[model samples]
Target: MGIDPTNPTGIKAFVFDVFGTVVDWRSGVAREAQPFLNRHAPDLDVSEFVDAWRREYSPAMEEVRSGRRPYVRLDVLHRENLVKVLAHFGIAGACEPEIDELNLAWHRLDPWPDAVDALHRLKRRFIIAPLSNGNIRLMVDIAKRGGLPWDAVLGAEVVRAYKPSPRVYSETAEILAIAPRELCLVAAHNNDLAAARRVGLSTAFVRRPTEHGPHQTSDLKADEAWDFVVDDLHELATQLGCAR
Candidate 1:
């Protein structure tokens, strides 16, 4: 039902989800909290706080994505949730600057083991960019921090809509100067892939079972039949006939 990149098919571009697809935001954010917690709340068990902090991701995104709340960057959403989560844990002693630095942890997420090399291979073969719910600035910051080789960055800010919205996918294609069918949406989230399929964009699923850590309960594997289901981004490059 979708174009296959390795078949010498019509797809010429790949749009990726940045958060979990390319970078391990959960673990990365949690790791980034380690030093600060070690210095401040040495015995506070920041691991639980990290997990609890991530629990708010969906609900926060839904507010902006569903139109119940106005467009807000994920950074702001993370911070908004961070405040509540910190209070919920009764973790105190953080000042404005400290909170600001913690808020930026999302921008410095480490890419998966094979993500960089694979992205380079994919970039060599096609127009590769991020099409995510993250704002352009945040995406750019992450790319720079992670050294991601993206030809361009596309985000919900560009379309004023989020994933699962046809307009977002369509707009990404338009911005890349490619047709919907010529673009493939690569993500770790099934909902994201499903949205691309509905909008006429090919889909590739890169499994990220550990994205939510030990408590991850969903998205352990591809749910819907996707055009491709690679174990990691590097495998995706190889499957697409990319050399090395």
Candidate 2:
């Protein structure tokens, strides 16, 4: 059912997918990597390299989600993935200290221009927190760095499971002291919303087409009939009547 932008049913809180939804991870990562690549490996493509690093995100977490590996934070997984991608490009001579610095780029990512303002608007009507793959400290750090007004920081680390796992959604709702139906998951990724929907949460889809750069193909539009679909976070605030 298409939600009336004017009315948000029972929603008391909005749980967000932080990476691509609230911030432009692709550009943020590439911006950090390009300087190093230009200085050391000028022939390498920055955007392509950043996308390659991002593609490793899900699979790296699967090992932990499946219990094949013990629970670890996204920060650790990010570092591991960065190492692998660097090796894949065969960019030798880069040491662990330098690679680790690059991995921290995820922690310090800048928000989309509208992200902070939108969150401030939404916070007036709803308790806002990140339901991201990032760990609690990581999300909190990013929020502090970017001036995001999150009511709380919650994510995979809090639940000890990656997203798409029912526990992540259900536990987040549990923590917020709200019913799953009253907790809306706002994200740019369809798969994240699909999982949240399956777990009985309300959903809002906001597009971030340039999130993965020009070659991006996925999530150009909402695939499923989500409750709400808006062009930007601020638009979502207007749709939800949260604007002040």
* Top candidate when judged by lDDT against the true structure: 2
Runs in model 2 with CA error above 4 Å? 1-8
lDDT of 2 at 30: 87
Q: Which 10 consecutive residues of model 1 have the lowest summed lDDT?
A: 1-10
lDDT of each: 0.85, 0.90
lDDT of 2 by residue, 22-137 (tens): 98888888889988798768999998898899989999999988889999999999988988888899888887788888888888889999999999999988899999999888
Please write out the lDDT profile of model 1 over residues 1-244, one tens digit for every residue.
6655456757799989988889988788878898878877787776787888888988887887788998877778889998998788677888989989988888888888898888899888799999988888889988888889999888788888877778999888898888898899999999888888988999999889888777788899899889899899878888888888
